[model samples]
Target: MLDQFLWVIFPYLCVAIFIVGHIWRYRIDQFGWTAKSSEFIEKKQLMVGSILFHFAVIPVFLGHIVGLFIPAHWMSAIGVNEHIYHLGAVYVGGFFGIVMFVGMFLLTFRRINNKSVRKLSSASDMVVNFLLLFITFIGIYATLVTNNIVTDFDYRQSISVWTRGLVTFSPDASLMTDVPLTFQIHVLSAFLIFALWPATRLVHAWSLPFNYVGRSYIVYRKHKK
Candidate 1:
């Protein structure tokens, strides 16, 4: 029952909330869709945190795509077996996970400690940062200690299958039942983040800077007197 709710029902609920929430927010508050960056308040911390977080997170996000979306059979057909996959996931995932964790920690610390940024920050801002930190920390711990170092638990058959099922609109909650507790928490935390994305600065992700690409360039002509 618990697994059913968490894996099946909760995922659908999150997606529903994510879609509806974004539309509602866009319609009601189109002007406030920006990230509300606090770069002007403190540049040094922002530079370090933003660079580390964004750069590290891109690869980490791609790693999740490969791990969850790609089926094990596909990998096997390509000569990538469980052993090789697990090893790469451990070492490569661990390195990027640590980088992301540190980046998040730095950003959170900067947000909290910097008086100017803190003055402009809201309760929701803090909550978002804290949630992200917790999620990243748990993910790194699961990768390093729980699965890699201790047990070679190949999640492809369980979490990956369950996740792919969700993507295909055929959720199988039972597959998540046998997954480890830490892995379960990581998945749940991710859903929570997705659910909250619309309400937070994360909404800015939808906004693309397309105007720069197609807009006219400025021309300053010299006046001959």
Candidate 2:
């Protein structure tokens, strides 16, 4: 029952909240849908951290899409075996994971230590930052220590299958029942983030500035003397 709740019920609940929350927030607070960037408050640390975090996180997000959504059989069909995939995932994922961790650390530090930034920051902002940091730290530890040094647990077999099942509306709680504890925490924490996403500035992630692409460029004229 515990496993069923954690693996099946909890995930669907988070997904439902994630979907409905965003719609409600968008309807009521469209103007507030922004990252609330603190570049003006503290440019130096913000620039460095924002650059590193955004750069690393894009690939990390894409990697998750591939790892979770793409089936192992599909990769096998393309001639990529388990050993090859694992090596690539470990090295490439680990590198980006470390970079993301450093970036998040800098961002979190700036938000907490810089008085100007802290003054502008809301409680939700701090909570989101800390949650992200925790998730990234656990991800790195899971990749480097838990999966590598402690034991060779190929999550693709269990976690990946279970994830695909969830999206397809046929989740198998049994798949997640025997996986490592670290992975279980990682998955649950990630869902928690998703559940909270709409309420936080993280909602800004969906508001890409695509309008800038086709919009006319600004033109400047010399002022009359």
Candidate 3:
């Protein structure tokens, strides 16, 4: 089936392309960091942009936990019904989507609008973000407009099994295709995003924010030789 072929190829290609691209890119970056100047003249917009990006990350992280880790019963026991949860996911996810979109758009525009950053920004880099935003738009619409879309009640278990297989370097292909189309796009995009993370300024996600904001540093005196 075309869907099955796409499911397998999409992930496989992302991994391969990422590995090969990273090796090439790393070598290139060793020569210099090519990022550009700031676009926002106002401090407030920059602050708000940073806030939106980080704020959205919370619910994004929580959604991963709930969808992949929390059992349905646990959610129900806590008084969160299925329909309500799905609806909440739609609105909350949309809020985060819009926030992230604005943040990413501004950041990308800054890169293009600023001469120094524009030179460094590549076709593939922009492609990755566009893919992410497109996938996210699909997710928002799927959540808001669809029903009977997420019929797989055992998604958590499947995710656990797939994760273990991936860790073992013996991933099971059978389980991968069972995911719903909506979920498939989301999962694939997330994986591609992760693969691309180390390559972009997106690696800023790993840096300590407090350290960045407050110039916090841990200094330990070295023992005398």
Q: Which candidate is the best by TM-score?
A: 2
Best by lDDT: 2
User: For every model shown, what is its TM-score relative to the native structure?
Assistant: 0.90, 0.92, 0.62
Better of 2 and 3 by TM-score: 2
**What's the true lDDT of residue 12 in model 3?**
65
- The per-prediction tally of clashing pairs is 0, 0, 1
Q: Which consecutive 10 residues in model 3 have the weakest lDDT in total?
A: 31-40
Local accuracy of candidate 3 as per-residue lDDT tens digits, 158-184: 654564555456556678676666656
Candidate 1 local lDDT, 57-76, one digit each (tens)? 98899999999999988989
Candidate-wise lDDT, in order: 0.88, 0.91, 0.62
- Number of residue pairs clashing in candidate 2, backbone atoms closer than 3 angstroms, sequence gap of 3 or more or interchain: 0
Error of 1 at 33 (Å): 0.7
lDDT of 2 by residue, 1-225 (tens): 988899999999999999999999999999999998878678998888888999999888988898998989899999998888888788999999999999999999999999989999999999999999999999988888889665657788899999999988999999987888888888999999999999999998887899999999999898999
lDDT of 3 at 46: 50
Global Cα RMSD, each model: 4.3, 3.0, 7.9
* Model 2 CA RMSD to the hidden true structure, in angstroms: 3.0
TM-score comparison, 1 vs 2, better candidate: 2
